[model samples]
Target: MKILQRKRKRIAAVLFTLTLMLCSCGQHAKTEQKHDWKAEAETASVYCVGKDDCFLCGTDAGYFGQNNIGIVSLNSFAVMPVEINRYDHNGQLIEENTGAMQMENFQNGENGMTVSVMLEPDRGIAHISISPNGDATLDLASAASHLCCDCLAELVSQLYGSVNGIGVVNFSTRRLYVLQEGVTSFGAGDYYVHCDYEALGGEIKILVIYSSLRYENLK
Candidate 1:
């Protein structure tokens, strides 16, 4: 009799497990992957890529503000150019410069970068600046002068730029928004088509890790 009762209990448990698994599917909630802010700031790499081809898990990244100063973790970051200036300087090395998003490969116009620590939570943390170059200046000549960031998921890999993908985590909103530039994808041949970020200062997107959209208020 006891053996029969045990068999019945096992079957009941299996049914419950199956039910839970079925219920868990089809949920589209954005969850933040917790990390130490200090650790991220300590080993951060600032970079950029043509916002054209870069995409998310199959979804077109869509265009962002002209100033795409986005961020992603080291492990998640894609390997792009090491630096911008080759002869006069060495790889975005402007003395105090920590690093850059060398977007020349993906940009169509005057490629420029602006640096900032405004994303920091408070004044106490603001002074702990990430880039040694004291918030690199924006490409004044370029058309775009703001910042946008993106991070990709398993849906589909970006056409170009950093493979890790860039995204943001908003604790207050309990939401995480991934950064993507446009709906279309750009290829090697396309690089020269719109190439003019240097002279025209068009849409420039940087991979950043900001906490809020307050950057929209940047002067």
Candidate 2:
């Protein structure tokens, strides 16, 4: 009985030590994950194109002419594309072009700028500002009489159709009234549609930015 009791106590001691070591390891890992890279990296002023040749000073990412800038979280790599064109200033065409380009070495909280492009012959123009937090507001407003709302709707619809389970796609051409609100409303320039899909496991909200854009599967 005495020998058995001693063995049980020894086993208990070993178990206690193992538990403490595991707890310490867990705490160390948590501390490591809390590290912030932005606080450590040096800040350098850089310029990005903002609104038709206008440039803003920010961090230099060593690449130029990129249309899209995304900030990625270190822990999850969750990417948030910074507001490239918030104002829809020259309408969505400029925003579309801006979104077409890819960014490199761009970091969060970096001051950025964008250049506006004159793709159309019309002199009438507008601009909108989307905040870093995704709040958008129009800075300038002008009627684009020649804006093709139907075409824009078709483009978005076509891109959405390519996705599996997206059905009965409907397009609407409406002039956007609220510059800050992201939703596409009735207008002659901006058009948007509500789409529903049967997703596996549950319903998912898929905001199809560009209809007819297909993603390639990278193995």
Q: Using TM-score, give the best candidate's number.
A: 2
| Position 71, candidate 2: lDDT | 25
Runs of candidate 1 with Cα error greater than 4 angstroms are: 25-185, 192-219
C-alpha lDDT values of all predictions: 0.27, 0.28
What are the TM-scores, per candidate, against the unseen true structure? 0.21, 0.25
lDDT of 1 by residue, 152-178 (tens): 221122222211222332222212233
Worst 10 residues of 1 by lDDT: 187-196
**Tens digits of lDDT, candidate 2, 29-146:** 8876554323321111121122233211222322122332322221122234333333343424343333234332322234222212221112122221212221111111111111
Best by lDDT: 2
In angstroms, give how far residue 57 of model 2 lies from its true place: 3.3
